[model samples]
Target: MCAQGTYITCANSPGQNFTGCACGQCAPPGCDGCVVHLAGGSTLRG
Candidate 1:
């Protein structure tokens, strides 16, 4: 399981990173992390 404060990185969109244990679900297989916030100030988490 991922611990809190875990760093995340997306392959498709490099340079963009986020930190959150729950963010693991947003990331694709083999990736450390993915973008949870989307455009227009909307979030993917909810």
Candidate 2:
């Protein structure tokens, strides 16, 4: 899914080709999308 209302899960989307479907909970081997954009300090990968 990618028509603005983004979505891209399905097992981390071909090994981290991100888009927008990172369903529900976050932990235990589950993550493909998170905080981004940096100018001074901003980062969270998982």
Candidate 3:
């Protein structure tokens, strides 16, 4: 699971797993969606 204030995207395909903590405000290429942990204590799906 991703830690608070972070996001993650993964797949069965090779090299698709990525963590947003390593790239703030940037989503991995080909990523269709992600779960973002907000500072307001809520999760947003995009």
Number of the top-ranking candidate, with TM-score as the measure = 3
Say what the RMSD of model 1 is.
9.6
TM-score of 3: 0.36
**Weakest ten-residue segment in model 1 by summed lDDT:** 37-46
Better TM-score candidate (1, 3): 3
TM-score, candidate number 1: 0.32
lDDT of the candidates, in the order given: 0.51, 0.38, 0.52
Error in Å for residue 13 of model 2: 7.4
lDDT of 1 by residue, 1-46 (tens): 4443444556565876655434545465666435455434444441
TM-scores for the candidates: 0.32, 0.18, 0.36
Q: Candidate 3 regions off by >4 Å?
A: 1-5, 10-17, 21-24, 38-41
Residue 44 accuracy (lDDT) in model 1:
46
Clashes of each: 0, 1, 0
State the lDDT at 36 in candidate 3.
51
Error of 3 at 9 (Å): 3.1
lDDT value, residue 38 of candidate 2? 30
Off by over 4 Å in 1: 1-5, 26-46
Query: Which regions in candidate 2 have their CA more than 4 angstroms from the true location?
Result: 12-17, 20-46
**Better model by lDDT: candidate 1 vs candidate 3:** 3
